[model samples]
Structures are given as C-alpha cells and as structure tokens.
Target: MAHCALEVADVFRSLGPGWHQSVNLSLGQLKVVSAIEQCRSAALGGHVLRCEGCAAIEVAYNSCRNRHCPKCQAAAARRWLEARQADLLPVEYYHVVFTLPAAISEIAYYNKAVIYGLLFDMAAETLRTIAADPKHLGAQIGATLVLHTWGSALTHHPHVHGIVPGGGLSPDRSRWVACRPGFFLPVRVLSRLFRRRFLEELEAVYHRGQLQFFGEHTELIDPGVFAKWLAPMRACEWVVYAKRPFAGPEAVLAYLSRYTHRVAISNQRLISLDERGVTFRWKDYRVDGRTRNKTMTLAANEFVRRFLLHVLPAGFHRIRHYGVLANPSRRENLSKIRALLHVALEAVDPDGDVSSCAAQPSFVCRHCGSPMIIIDMLQRSRPIRAPPPEQCHA
Candidate 1:
C-alpha cells in the first residue's frame, strides 16, 4: 500500500506539545502522544538494510509498537492472524455487535477499565447463555470479541464486535451442533440478557464504590440519583445485532485481519492539516451509500482530545476469546472439534520445514524484488529532552 502523506503522528507532532500545556492529561494519554510523535522516527532507532539483488541501501526507523499507533497495528494484526489461522473451522461464521447505550457510555468514559471489562464479560456471557439453552442452538459456542471504543467521528461510542461460529459442540461433546443454515442466535434475546447482566454488574460496582462520577455526573454518586439515572437505560433497547454469516473461512479471516487490530483511525483517513484545522474523512453509519462518506475538521486541540478519549486503561486486554476458544484449553478443544467434525487437523508445512521461511528477510528492495539484509544496527537515540520541572508545572 502507498504511504499516506498525512498521518496521526503528523497531527501529534504538530499540536501535541501545545495541547499538553493546556490540558491535564493522564500519564497514559501523555505516553501515547509522545510515542506517536516519535514512532518510526530516528528517536526509536532501527537497522540499516541492503538489498541482495540491487545493492540498494535503506535506513529504516523503528516503530513505537504502541497498540494505539495506526502505523504499528499492521504487523501486530499479521502476527495475530497467523496464530489464529489454525483455529478456523470449516463452519460458517457470524458477526455480532453489542453496543452500550449512550448514557452508559458516558459513565464508561470515566470508568473505562471497569465498564469495558464488564462489557466484554457480559457480551461473552450473553452469547454463551443464549446459545446453551435447549431451545436455541443448544450447544457450547466459541466467540472472539473485539472492543471498539470510538465512533466514526471519534466520539466515545463503546461497542464489542463478536465473531462467532454458526454452531458448537453438543453438551456431551459427541457431535457438532450447527445453527440453522443462515441464522445464529436471536439478537433480541441476546440484547436483553446482555443489558440485564451489565446493569446488574454496574450497580454492584457502584455499591462497592468502584465507580467515579465527575462534572454533571457528580449527582450520580448518590444511590437514589444513580438508580434514577439508570432507569431509562433499563427500558431502552441496547443495540445488539448479528449480520449474515461470512461466505466462508477465508472471508472470516479477511474480516478479522481488518477489525482485530484497528486503531481509532488510520493514517489513510487523514486528509490534511492546515490553517483551518485537522481535516479527516469519516463515515456516518446512520446514513446509507456514498453520502455516509464525509470529511470533518476539528481544531487541532479538539481533535487531539477526541483521539485521546480512546487511550484505554493501562494493560487492558481489548481482544478476548470465550467459551470453547477460551485460552486455557483452546488447543485441545480445537483438536476435539476438528475430530468431531471429521475435518483434518491443521497441517504443518509440507516436509515439516519452516527454517527456510524463517530465514527470509522482513523487508525487500523497493526497486528490485529481493530480500534486504540487515547490514547494521542503529542504537536508540536519547529521548527528547523534557521541559524543566518549573516550566512544565507552569
């Protein structure tokens, strides 16, 4: 793919220092700003490469490898997909989404770790509960859920995207029980259960004094007010819907490759940064067709603020697997399921040799198709100097 002329790093490099002076940002958010600014720049040193075929030399800079960095996710996604490739079954797969209501999302902005963890748990539980019912699929299903905290316009809209197989193993583990050819579980049922479980947990967390309220939400610190505030969400419909099943395993892998490691926005979507503001393209899902694609510009400060809204709590796992695919027993479970389905176990490379592939260089010559060998190491540069303590505090 062609490199984007504009990138999030460019926006951060231009406005981040000034924004930092004006805003009181968390340590995590501040690190994100600094990392993006220096990503793939000389600040993080990288090795020099020389092409075997063309004898061309190139200097490559190291990526920050921050999960939130758009430039860093491609390799991360590639590595993740390779690991998951063996987990794919021949069965059809479905895409489901469970979204927190706007009111809850507002609370989530302050309690991201607690609320986002609840979202993942409840979504996974809802799927398992509904799927195991004798009346529904009546089987144990596995699902991979990915958390996306941003809307197209960089708004705080928290949702979990679920990739689930259309079927599961029988209670006794004797047979593979598949859902109806086209349908997975009922969305209405899943949504109601998810809403109930999430609210119950939220209330519990509130009682434990784990939730914090600020600004207009300060009144919610009172139990009565918090209950009243949650009243509307109890009756409102939480968005949970499942799309049609993927065409096949290949299509499912393709979908995972795109959604699994995505950041809030890609560099490709950035249009330009100029006197007007930072302009970028975004999709309005509420609309249909070409009209949904539109550009919006925000003052650099506001843009940075919106972008940081999704930094997430430190050490949070945004991607999770549940049910049969649960990490503890995934390999054994996959082995059993493949046997039950009469499918062959995932094959190793023919001749059982991988050293050849491993020996290949990661980069190639731009002009000639030949492996580029690392000719020399580049030590990391000293970190950019920070302002003096008095000046920083000022």
Candidate 2:
C-alpha cells in the first residue's frame, strides 16, 4: 500500500522550510508565513487509537485548524453553517457582493488590518441602512458577511459577500415585507451606495491617520494620495451583483459552507509535491473554470510565494455582522425577526440539524470568554494487543 504519513507533521517536515524561505524573501509576503509554520506540526497532543480493519498504528496529530490554514477550514465551514440552521428564516435569500475600488485596494493590502476591517463594517452597515430605508424594504434585515482577499487569479482584491434574506420586517417590526420574489435589492443602487459608503469610511480612517503605507505605498500617506485614489472609484461602477437567490434554505446553507472558513487553497487540490516543483490545481476564472481543476506547476519558491501572499494581520476578522446581526442586536433582533417571519420554530429536527449544518465558530475555550481555540492536535497510534482474556493464565 502507498502509505503516507497520517499526521500534519509529516507534511510540514517536507514543506515548512520552503515556506520559511518564501517569507524572508519578501516583506510583502510575510503575512501568512507564521500561519503556515504554526500549522505544520501537532503542538496539541492526542492519544493513540487503533484502526479496526488494518490495525495499523500511526500518529494522527491534531490540526491548528485555523481558518487561514487550508488544512483546517473545511470542517470549520461546515460547523459554522450547521449552527446557522436555527437562525435561518423561511424566505428567499440573496447573495450580495460589495467590492472596493482598485484604486483603494493597492493601499488596502498594505493596511489590511485597518482598511479591510473598515470594508466589512461599511459594507454590512450599507446593506442594513439601505434595507431599513422605508423606500427599500423598511424592515431591519439580517446578513452574514464574509471577507475575501483574493480574486480567482490570486490578486489581492478585497470584497464582502453578504447573504441576506429576501425581505425584512416593516418599520413597526410587526409586518413581514416579503422581498420581490426574484430580486432582493436592486444591484445597481446597492453597488453605488456601497461604493460611496466604503469611500467615506476609507476617508475617515485615512484622516485619522489609522491607515499605514510602507515601501512604495508610503506616498499614499499624503492627502494627495487619498484624493488621487478616491477620484476614479467615485465614478467607478462598484460591483454589487445579486446572484440567483437560493431555491431554499438547504441551498443557502450549502452555499455558505464553502466560503465561511475558506483558506487560499486546500490540500486535496495538491496533485504532486516532488522536485518537479509544486503542481497544484487553480481555477481559471476568466473562463469560468472554477469548477474544473486546472493543474498549475510552479517553482517551489514561487508556489510558496503565492501561498504566503494571503496571510491576514493577526486578530483581524474575516467574517463579521451588521444591522440586526450585529452583536448588540443579534439575539433580540433575531427573536423579533423569527417571530415576524414565522420561522421561530426551525423546521429541521434537532438531531438532523447536527448532521446537516455547520455553525460559525467563536473559538472560545468554553472555560474562558477569550478567543481560545485548539491550535493543533498530535495523535499517535497505539499498539494493538492480542486478546488475552480468554487465556488469563498466561
């Protein structure tokens, strides 16, 4: 049998050094280096267990399971969506995207900690504000916003994808105003508002000197940089498209499961890792090749370089809430919305819920309120002993 090491440690043993080199090579790419290194070994230990059929013994160390760690996000995404089941409403939900102007994104990457954070807040607020406008829906809506930094080509494009219910409660919070059956919010109007709100927030952050620019981006620190950067986007058509709303709740959960804990890439996508450089699959988005896996072979150095480009600043949030979903109002607003939408009773059975949906994780230690989570797990195989009970005399 072609047996490979079962634990993440083995993968890191072969790959960690290259990642470290990839980081030191570029100041710009250093963001994800530590994240990858931390994910390489099993710092969190686990007891050994024996396999039933093969009775093979191997170490199955724990995983860092960081959302950014490709090794960990899949299970996380599923869990997040699972919990969402109880929160979902029985209405069509729309997928709305809010994109930052290219003029700003260049600087945004350097100041990702601030600018991207602002983008999420602004985007979510815009959605909430607009939906609450007596002109739009009048009902305060709920949204799940997720941040993504890369475009299909691996370029640093900051954007937020919002999954929102079709309609919201009337201003009085008594009547349920169903959204246009097919359309949620008008895409064009939402896009423009999103652009303006984002730019305004960007300016606020800039004026406060909260934004940082390093190396070639140092020029952007000047007000002139802000003005020059803001001009093009002021007129640019910000893309806030409404995809076909989900056919139902099942579809909604399925859609979000792929994105909630997404990392730059996953391990299964890697085809080969030998001296032939690193061959992996990437989507050719220009041609809608997202579903079809196209193999990309890059020099080991280049591969590491691309992989490290996505690391976010430590403690930055890639997922966020707005409007009724914001922390202060989440519980109360959810209760009201549930009553209004007549979905207070989750249709799915409790037992069935666990197997089907994944919840957004808090990473809490349970013992403490801090953002605590398992960083890694290390598992070792146990030796299988013969059944001696039958001949205890030995």
Candidate 3:
C-alpha cells in the first residue's frame, strides 16, 4: 500500500536544488532542506529483507530523522510517546494554548533563539502562577509544553501547546487538589498575566540588546522607538485558552502524538503539484463558515520560502516540562502524587506476557500477509548529484 499519495520529500527532490540556486538561506535552513531531500532514500542506506512466507525481497531505506522533515516525525513522536506513557497520572489533563501576537512575530523571525526561549518561560510561568493563586486552583501543577512556530499554510505564528494535569499537590505537598470538572484555570486571568509578564521580560531583553532588528524593524534598535512599539501590544488581549479535560490518560496520549512533533506541513495535506505550483489544504481559523478548509497554491519558490521560515535555532529545545513535571523531580513527584490520590502504579508485565503494545514490526510481507525478516544490511553511500548552486532560496 502507498504510505502517502504525495510526500514532502518529493517536493524537495523536485524543487529544492532549483530553490537553492536562486536565493540566500541560513545554515540551519540549508541543512533542513538537504535533510528532507535525502530522507527515506538510498543515500541514507537500507536493509534488505526476505518474506518468510513467499520469499519476496524488499528494501527499506533509513530516514534522515531530522526534526523538520515531515516523513521523520511519526517515528520520533512514537518513540517520545512511549517514554511518556509511564509519566501519565490518573488525574484529568488539560490542553492550553499560548499564542504570540503578530507584532512580536516579525521580531521573532530574526531573534528566534532569544524570543522563543522567552516565550516558553513566560508561558510556563503564567500557568504555574495563576494555578497557584488561592482564587484559582491554589496548587502547584505540572505541565508539558511543546513549541510550534508555524500555523497552517506555513505562516510564522509562534505558539505553545501545554498539556497540564488538571490538579496539583497542595502547598504542603500532602494532599491531592483537583480542579472542578471540565475546568482548569481562568482564561482571562491567564491572558492578563501572560501579557504583562511577557512584555516586562521583552523590555528587559531589548535593553540588554539581546534582540536584533533588521529590514523594516531597524528603527526598533532605538530604546525609545522600541518602547513605543510595544505600548499597544500591552493592552491588546493575548490569546490564552484551555480546552476541556481529556477523556483519560489514553486520550491524552493520543493528543500528544499529534501535536508534539508536528512540522510546518505534513505529506497528507498535499493535494497536487503542477505548473501552477504546490496546492495544499489549510484551515482559516479567522473564518467562521464552511469555507474555512480551503486549498492554497503558491509558486514553487514561495512554497519553499514559507517552509524554510520555520527552521528553529539549532540545539534550542521545542519540547519542555515544567513545575512538578520538570525532569529532575518527575519520578519522585509522580510517586508522591500517586500516594496522595490512592492510585496504584500501572501493572507490570512479566516475562513471556503479551506486551502492552506490539514491538515495532521490523518488516511486513506484502505478498502473503506475513512478517519479513532482515536478511542483509546495506552500507550507506554519499549520493552523487550536480553541484548545488552557490546561492540558495531564502
């Protein structure tokens, strides 16, 4: 069966070299483009397999495993989810989204490392601070925050999706405190605090010269101009909304699998590619009608430009845990929370017991519906191609 009718790799393979020849790009963007073009191909090497039932031979190529490659995220997400399975608490889970305004998005394009890092800190602090207030949940909660830098249609709209347990440990750390059913924290309270704290920290960064301005934003280099530019955003409402609690742990896991490793666009969204260029489906959240799910086609060069806009700063983390779920104290915190809630740990499977989920199937026989085994390993070789142009698309 075909994995996908159209793949992101195909688009890169067809247009990437040409795009590279025409524009200037950062080292990170260039690397991501190259990685996507080579993913799941012979250049990365493969395994030769033989079907046990019919002696059919098949070769499976290795994936580049780049964070920005659409083809590589599924495996990465599955591996991440497997590790997180044990971290699940029996309590309800909430989904909260913290979005950056368009005013800051322009600045973020040039100062990604500083701005994005600040966004994460402010978002986590917002949730923790509001939840700890006596008028709100009044406890210390844990959250898993994943950063997404693009919206549908590959536009630069930075946001964080937070997965928070619906309750927390009392200040004394001796009791389980749960929020009322279907609610987590007040959105208005969260929005106000998030906006105030974000602006305060942003001003500090500007004064420290931690941010850079380019193109139309060069005026922002002056402290007076920058402060005035930030004035209007202080009063505009920031988007901070929480969804209803998930059905249970399994539901939360299912949701996490979709959000944690998503790229600018997925293969499944592609509709067609022709002389007119690339067409894909995107949802317009600004609309409130049936026409929201619309098809957009961009010239080949524009499409590549939009895709490369989201390549994050190298070594900057996109997934993070905060508060009680912070990595250093996660295990001990979970143990204490479980005790307070009177919930037992998940049952362990003994040797020879059926696994909770099947091990990754190494292979499958297309002819006889049987499993395929690796019979031989292939060595990787550098791909031979025309020399890429000195200039690449931006």
Candidate 4:
C-alpha cells in the first residue's frame, strides 16, 4: 500500500511539544503523543534490509507499536484476525453497537477505567441476559466486543461494536439454536436493559467512591447531586442497534479487520496541515448520502487535544470476548458447536493468503518480488529525551 502524503505522526511531530506544554494531559495521553511523534522515525532504532532477488538495500525505521497509533494498527489487526479466523462459525454474524449518551461520555472522560469497564461488562451482560431468556433466542451466545471512544470528528463518543453469531447453544448443550432469519435480538429490549444496568452500576461505583469528578462536574461529587444528574439519562433511551447479518465468514473477517484496531482517525482522512491548522474529512451521520462526508479544520492545538482525548488507560483491553466466546473456553466451545452443526472439518490455512494476514518482510525488492533479510541494526544517533516528571510514568 502507498503511504499517505500526510500522517498523524506528521501532525504530532509538528505540534505536540508546544501543545503539550500548554495543556494538562494524563501520563497515558502524553505517552501516546510522544509515541506517535517518534513512531517509524530516526528516534527509534531500526534495521537495514537487503533484498535476496535484486540485492536492493533499504533502511526501515521501527514502529512505536502503540495501540492508538494509526500506522501500527494495520499489522496488529492482521495478527489478531489471523488468530480469530479459527473461531469463525459457519453462521450469520450480526453487528450490534451500544453507545453512551453525550452526558455519560463527559463523565467517562474523567473516569475511563471504571466507566469503560462497566460499559463492557454491562453490554456483555445485556446480550447474555436477553439471549438466555426463553422468549428470546433461549441460548448461550458469544460475542466479540470492540470499544471505540471517538466519533468521525474525533469527539469523545464511547461505544462498543459487538460481533455476534446469529444464534447460540441450547440450554442442555445438546443442539444448536439459531436466531430468527436476518435478526439477532430486539434492539429496543437490548437498549432498555443496557441503560438500566449501566446506570445502576455507575451509581453503585459512585457510592463506593470509585468515580471521580472534576471541573464543571465537581458538583456531582455529592450523592444527591449525582443521582439528580443521572435522572435524565435514566429516562432517555440508550442507543443499541443491530445491523443486518454479514453475508459470510469472509465478510465478517473483512469487517473485523477494519473496526477491531482502528484509532481515532486514519491518515487517509487527513487532508492537509498548514498555517490554517489541521483539515480532515469526517462523516456527519445526521446527514444523508454523499453530503454526509465533509471536511472540517481545527486549530492545531485543538486538534491535538481532541486526538489525545481517546488515549485509553494503561493495560486496558479494548478488544474483549464474552459469554461462549470468553477466552477461557472459546476453543472447546467452538469445537462443540461445530460438531452440533455438523460442520465438516477441513484443512485450511488459518492465515488464509500469504499476501494478506501473514507477516511480510519489512522491505521487498521493487524490481523482483523477493524476501528482504535484515543485515544490520541502526542505533539511535542521539540520546532520546525523557518525558516530563509528571508524565513519566505509565
């Protein structure tokens, strides 16, 4: 793939130092900024590669490998998808999204670890709870939930994208239970349950002194005040909707490859960064058709601020598997399900195509398609500067 003329690294490298000095950022956010600025640059040591076919030589810089780095996720996504290919069931896959309202999103910014954890747990619970009901699917289902904290314009829109099979195993574990054709579960039922459980859990966390409030929300530190604030949200509808089932397992993989490891924005969406600030494309979901795609520009500092808003707390797993797909028993569950469905075991490469999931050499000869071998390591020419004391940890 051709590299984009502009990248997030370019934006960060140009504005990060000055912007960070003027703003307050968590240690995690600071690390993200620094990592993106130095990613694939001379600051990080790299290796020299020589092609076997044409004997072409090239120098490749190392990637920062930060989960939030746009340049790093493509490779990470490929590896993750390759692992997930084996778990694919020959059944319809449904896409479900659960979004926190704007009010809750503001609170999540301050309490990401707690609130985000609740979002995952509550979402998973909501699905399992609804699906297990006899009136509903009446089976145990598995889902892969991926959390995305940014909207098209880099706003703090915390949501989980769930990939679910159309059905699950029966209660007795004797047979496969499939969902209604082209439908997974009722969105309204899911939405109602999700809202009730999440808010209830959030209130409990607040009482336990696990949630923190700041700035305009400091008044929420009071128990009564917090309860009053959550009143509106309790009455409002939480967004939980499911899309049509995917055509096949291939389509499901294709969708996962795109959404599973995405950052706040991609390099391709960036148009230019100049004295006018950073201009980028965004989709206005409120609009229809081609008009939905529009470009907006933000002052450099503001752009960096918005981009950093999405840096997750350290050691948080943004990609999670729940219920039948839970990491502990996924392989065994899949084998049982395959048997119940009478799926024939076939010999197939988990990596699929060499040009796809399999890792490619860092460099290949342009003249002849041949592997590139690492010949030497390139050490950093200068000592790397340390981060500020406040931003040094995490």
lDDT per model vs. reference:
0.88, 0.67, 0.87, 0.88
Q: Which prediction has the highest TM-score against the true structure?
A: 1
Q: Specify the poorest-scoring 10-residue window by lDDT in model 2.
A: 385-394
Provide the lowest-lDDT 10-residue window in model 3.
347-356
Write the residue-wise lDDT of candidate 1 on 1-394 in tens digits. Answer: 2578999988877774566766767767777877888888888899899999999999998988889999999989977777787788989999999999999899899899999999999999999999999999999999999999999989999999999999998999999999999999998999999999999999999999999998999999999999999999899999999999999999998999999999999998899999888999998877644448899999877888899999988899999999999998787888899998889955545332322345556997888979899999898885533333443432
Local lDDT at 191 for model 3: 95
Cα-based lDDT at residue 202, candidate 4: 90
lDDT of 4 by residue, 1-394 (tens): 3678999888877774566666677667877877877888788889888989889887888888999999999989988887788889999999999999999999999899999999999999999999999999999999999999999999999999999999999999899999999989999999999999999899899999998889999999988998899999988888899999999999999999999999999999999999998999999987654448889999877888899899999899999999899988887898899999999645446443333434666567666879889999988654333366664432
Off by over 4 Å in 2: 1-44, 51-59, 274-276, 288-293, 347-394
The lDDT of model 3 is: 0.87
Q: Return whichever of 2 and 3 wins on lDDT.
A: 3
lDDT of 1: 0.88
Q: What is the lDDT of residue 69 in candidate 3?
A: 89
